[model samples]
Target: MEVTYLCPHCIGAINALDNIILSAKTEKNKHGLILLHEEIWNYSVIQTSSINAELGEIVDFFCPVCHASLNTEKGDHYAGYIRMDASGQESKIVISREYGDRRTFKITGEDIESYGESARKYMYPEWFL
Candidate 1:
């Protein structure tokens, strides 16, 4: 089954090949394109050499199309977008912005599922709805 990632702001397709691509900027002002595995639980990253993201460093993410900042408005150290599954059901996907923090959340209405190294039950994020 395939899943499509979309920019919450622009609703533009953000996934290509087997990766989800986003524009990112490190706290130190280094910018690059970030490629993350389309598989939600995979933490592997492919980014330009300019982005030397250190552990716990916040890397700001933006939609490649509309350039909308993906950061969650609550400043909870996460960035988010929409994920549409093959069946056309949509969910909100949120991931930690801190480099090396493998925290991810998939929120479908009131159901919140988590994945990655730091997976945990999460509160339903009304802002992402």
Candidate 2:
């Protein structure tokens, strides 16, 4: 089943061709497009040649459609959006904003499903939801 990701603000679909496209800006003020693998936990990423993002570097993620920042209200350490499965089940998807910090969370109601090795850093994932 294919899952579609949407910007939390504009509710615009963000995934295309199995990649979640997001506008990104690094701390160095470099801007570019970031393509993240749509499958949760995959962690495959591709950045435009214009950007030079180092591993473990944190970058700002934004909705490519509305240009609204996707940074979670919880903290800059994560970015969040909405995810809908093929059956139309929707939930909140939060991911580590820092490059190479493999943490992802799927929040549905009071339930929190954590994935990736770095997810262990957050012992209680429900607080963010």
Weakest lDDT window of 10 consecutive positions for candidate 1: 120-129
Error of 1 at 75 (Å): 4.0
Best by TM-score: 2
Model 1 per-residue lDDT tens digits across residues 16-62:
99999999999999998989998998999988888867888999999
lDDT of 2 by residue, 1-129 (tens): 789999989999999999999999988889999998998879888999887788888889999999999998776588989999999988988888898888999888888989899889778655676
Model 2: lDDT of residue 67: 99
Tell me each candidate's TM-score.
0.91, 0.94
Steric overlap count per candidate = 0, 0
The local distance difference test score of model 2 is: 0.89
